[model samples]
Target: MNFSEHFLHFIWKFRLYKTLDLFCVAGEQLRILNPGISNTDAGPDFNQAKLSIGGTYWIGDVEIHLKSSDWLVHGHQQDPAYDAVILHVVHEHDQPIYRKDGSQIPVLVLKNLYPEHLLDHYHQLVNSIHKFPCEKQIGEIEAVVVNGFLSRMMVERLEQKSALVLDKLSRLTGDWESAFYCFMAKSFGFKVNEIPFELLASALPLQVLRKHLDHPLQVEALVFGQAGFLSGSFKDEYPRKLKKEYAFLKKKYGLKPIGVGAWRFLRMRPQNFPTLRLAQFSALVLKSDRLFSKILEIEELSDLIKLLAELPVNPYWIKHYHFQKETKEVKLQLGISSVHHLIINAICLFLFSYGKYADQPQLISRAIKFLELIPPENNTIIGWYKSSGLIVESAFFSQAVLQLNKYYCAQKKCLNCGIGIKILNK
Candidate 1:
């Protein structure tokens, strides 16, 4: 049976091998009382295991390798961390292994012990060239297992986003509001203009914007000016007035605008233009006393949606997509889809990150609850998973499938996935 050492771990971890009449290479009867916990750290493959050899019980670590000589190849023979290892399990016993103290480490060869079908199934799934390796067979698994795994995956997705939030928080000296402002700015960009939006946030700090929030026009001027949008000569009276207002504010605040080249507008919808997003973002700032604080206080998903959806954007944005450029009149209010995007990317991440940092499990729970309350995202990736037999009913499952696709299915890490393990064992 050809398999990686990870496959050996799976076999040993789940006890997917024959157990009757087991014996060590030293010719002593072996019985596994407990397989112990799988260790992710460097010390051992399995920790605190209990097993009987030659009518004597031993409790220590168990190290597995493709060959007995791998102990020396990996330099575990010299590393003091491996000194507590009591047994060496291998697929093939090429040579006897010894501790540094000259005592032999008992060896167990699993060459013909485990079921071969498990290895065969693993190979078939990993080696498949389809977009999703298990796409053809994933539907065969029970719904309970699939949903359970996806739920775990959704939390994993949140944890990953929380790490990013924590990193940003650290840079801002643990200020949650500032971190939220910057991240929300990035989310507003929605991939196409994310970088410029982030740069705009850095260029104009939230504190500076706070002082002028009472005057919505001045707030819009500062946001647009720092975004490098108001620098151009404009034919419109509103933009010209904003340019004049920004010229004074820019110097007063000692601010430098990001390059105009950072914004992209070649092939996007007129409504998603960076100019329009900045207008909406500025309105949002003017409407709130402290935006992140308001977000924290919001308990119900509907309230949170209402808070974002009811932004007081200036009516100028309703008729214009860019400065000096007027388009057909259109409503510039934040759409439900856009509000959901903010909730998923910005609100959920901050809630989860702050919860973790401040040791508040309730906030983390609320973050998850918010995702469950929202609808599933409509995107190419989610569409692909739905077509491949995965049931995505809400943002919770959609987020999980996104995480699973990027980290596991795309990378072919089948052995580490619960669904993959089930299919293999079946």
Candidate 2:
């Protein structure tokens, strides 16, 4: 099996190659003082590597390839970016490599220095047909190793989530409440109608909803109307009343409702219907003033849960999933599981982003603590890990495992993962 350049970078980064009797192509003794940081962007593979060669110390970037000829194959010799490379490391020293100035760069062949067994193990894991590359060996790894990787993975997931929050904040012109409102609206839509809900949120600004908070009817009218639920004729008094209120509000605010086609109802549970979700969302807006501010002040998971749960749909929605569609009366309150999902995907991420933007470490810690208090999410990916003998105790571990599975395991990035590195080193 052919190893990727990423694998070679991994081997070099961790000093996995045999160090005894090391020499360059010029027959000069070579020692790696520092392997340097791995560069993900254009230019060399690793940056600022420290090397001692023939009683001379050089500090510059390091470039690696499967073969020495790849230096030319990738056109790096013609680029000025490779001029500062202090060392050329490759698996095979098939040909000589030259720098931009037509000078020979010292080459370190890593083929025999690293253990063949480790490469074989990596190939086996990568070529495996199992859902997880390490399915068979995951149980054999130490718990501490797995836990450490999980903790790091969890933060990785949070950082990814924070990026989205940051982007939303930028789009909202630094309006934290608007960004939170858009994010919360998307979460309320769940997976089936996330886009339509986001569109609804964007079309109807948070400030508009805040102005109508004093009247729940007007709030529902604005949310439901902007969502395009009031477009068609309704046989119910509540929807007709909302329609009348929305007609006036739409004209006053110069608002246009999103197309009704944006929402999907097929195969979704009645409780998760767009109409009910809009009603619940309107209730949330009505109950909370400065929702993002309140979220920042939250100290406990239960308090956050209570804040989310306090907003229940009005009486009419208790008996109706949609306008003109009356069913048996149900509580129509947000379920604990759905609330937890929102808190995990929206509230915690928003808090984390706020903490990062404001430079408040305690807020960041609280956001992570909130995740710890929540239970593990039940999903197919989490189920797959559990089936493989891995225990998920909290949202933290679950989120970490999710990131590990999606970003590293599924992507065949074993060499970059701590678990995969441990497995390979063993």
Candidate 3:
């Protein structure tokens, strides 16, 4: 039986070899005496595991290989991570290896203990046209039970996002609403521009934004300056004026400029440019004083959606970013799709970050239902999940994939994973 990356992760997570005796690549008896730190930052490579070989028991660390020959095959002798490894575990034992310090690293072949049924399932799903590793028998697994699994998945999802929340919250002087504003802006930028938006947030501090509450020009300066737009020279007097204003504000706020390319507009319609987005985004932030607090108070989805229905774009931004020769009113409203996506993502992060003990059942349930009310996400992660059979074709399937990946694959907490437990029992 050949091993895969998933199998390696499975071993680290489940310690699946505990029930059987181990063997070196030479077919000699090997034994596992310990499983070490699973979350160590810097150690003898992959999370430490201890084992004994022959009568000479050793305890340094453990590393994985597809075949025993991988020791020499991958040049493990050169990697510092493998130097302290006492035992090398592989699916097919084919060769021996030595440490950089010249100690022999014992090899243990794992196929003897791995069940054929499991291997069959793996081969069947992987070889098929279906996307998921277990797509063929997914229906055989109880849907009722799967929903329960989703409950756990949702819980996990929120915990993951909540950590990010706390990190940003810490930087926001522990102000949840302020952190939410930053979070929302970054999410709007999406993966293509996450780092840029983060830099944008840092460049334009909340204090700077708050000071400009009543003035559109101040809002423009804050957004453009933070986004690194006001750095360059524009031929127009208006942009020049904004740049001058930004310089004073930057010094007063001790702003370190971000490296965001001005929010794009070349290929986009005039409405999609950095200029318009900044104007629209600024208006929303200025109007909403306590964003997180207001969101928590919202009792219905419609009520929350109502918050995004208006255009925050300043009057001058209606037709012109710099000068107005032509008059046209472009109402800068939040796209409903964008708002729903952001709220769902935020709620997922909040619940997942806490893991199993936090017990936020109602919030997770509401979040899922809210996601169901919306359309499937149209992004890479969601697209990949859909392609892999992790989600069915439906509005809520995207959230289900998000939920499942968090609780199952990403966390490696598979014993708690509904699908993992089901497959194991099978």
Candidate maximizing TM-score: 2
User: What would the per-residue lDDT of candidate 3 be over residues 336-365, giving only the tens digit for each residue?
Assistant: 776776666664344333222247566555
lDDT of 1 by residue, 25-126 (tens): 999999999987999988989999999989999999999999998888999988999988888999999899888899899998988998878888988998
CA RMSD of each candidate after superposition = 1.7, 1.4, 6.8
Ranking by TM-score: 2, 1, 3
Candidate 2 regions with alpha-carbon error over 4 angstroms: none
lDDT tens per residue, model 2, 1-426: 277988888889999988878999889899999999999999998998999988799999999999898888999878998999989998889998777677889999888898888889989999889989999888888999999999999899989989998998888899999999999999998888999998999999998988877898999999889988888888888889999999999999999999989999999777888888888888899889899998898898998899888775788877888888888776677899999989988998888889999999999999899899899999999888888888899998998999999999999999989999999999
Model 2 compared with the native: what TM-score? 0.96
For all candidates in order, the CA lDDT equals 0.89, 0.89, 0.63
Residue 158 of model 2 has an lDDT of 88
Q: What is the TM-score of each candidate against the true structure?
A: 0.95, 0.96, 0.64
